[model samples]
Target: MDFPETVRWTFAGLACLTLAALVREIRRLRRAEPGGRARVRWDAADQGAGLVLTVGGALGSLHLFGAGLVLTGVVLGGKAVRAVRARRRTTVGRPST
Candidate 1:
């Protein structure tokens, strides 16, 4: 089945957004003052705005652009959640004395 160009381009843009999100979150994750463990939060408004702008620029207002932006947002959001989960998992169930 052939996927719409909107969907395909959107998916690609979304992947790129996730990558950018990782870069941004990685910096924050490394810099965060750990109360217990470090968790990356990529849902920052700034990032969202950036996604909108990035996707918008990548795929103008051809309707597909909006879809691309939404996909990008989702990818970024998923990455954020996964990062936190990974941090939690790593910190949990350690061999205690």
Candidate 2:
């Protein structure tokens, strides 16, 4: 494979691995706390995965796969933003230790 194709596959593979890890974490949390209060906080890895997926999708040129990847990326990115906002909100009123 050429450079661009190789890069694309690499990104895609990384994104998939990130996604798999996220799913595993979620499942573990669910099992540990069946009440559903265990939330998955989106971190840097999630953000990076979303970004890679988004760019890869845009450059992929395959309609269906591209659309799916783009949509997943958007959702992941949005969730990460929301998680950050929520975290900030929780700490806003607390005095610095």
lDDT of 2 by residue, 68-92 (tens): 5666676676777777988999999
TM-score of each: 0.37, 0.40
Cα-based lDDT at residue 62, candidate 2: 58
What lDDT score belongs to each candidate, Candidate 1 first? 0.61, 0.59
The candidate that achieves the highest lDDT relative to the unseen native structure: 1
* Candidate 1 TM-score to native: 0.37
Misplaced by over 4 Å in model 2 are: 1-3, 34-38, 41-97
Leading candidate by TM-score? 2
- Quote the positional error of residue 67 for candidate 1 in Å: 21
Displacement of residue 73 (Cα, Å) in model 2 is 7.8
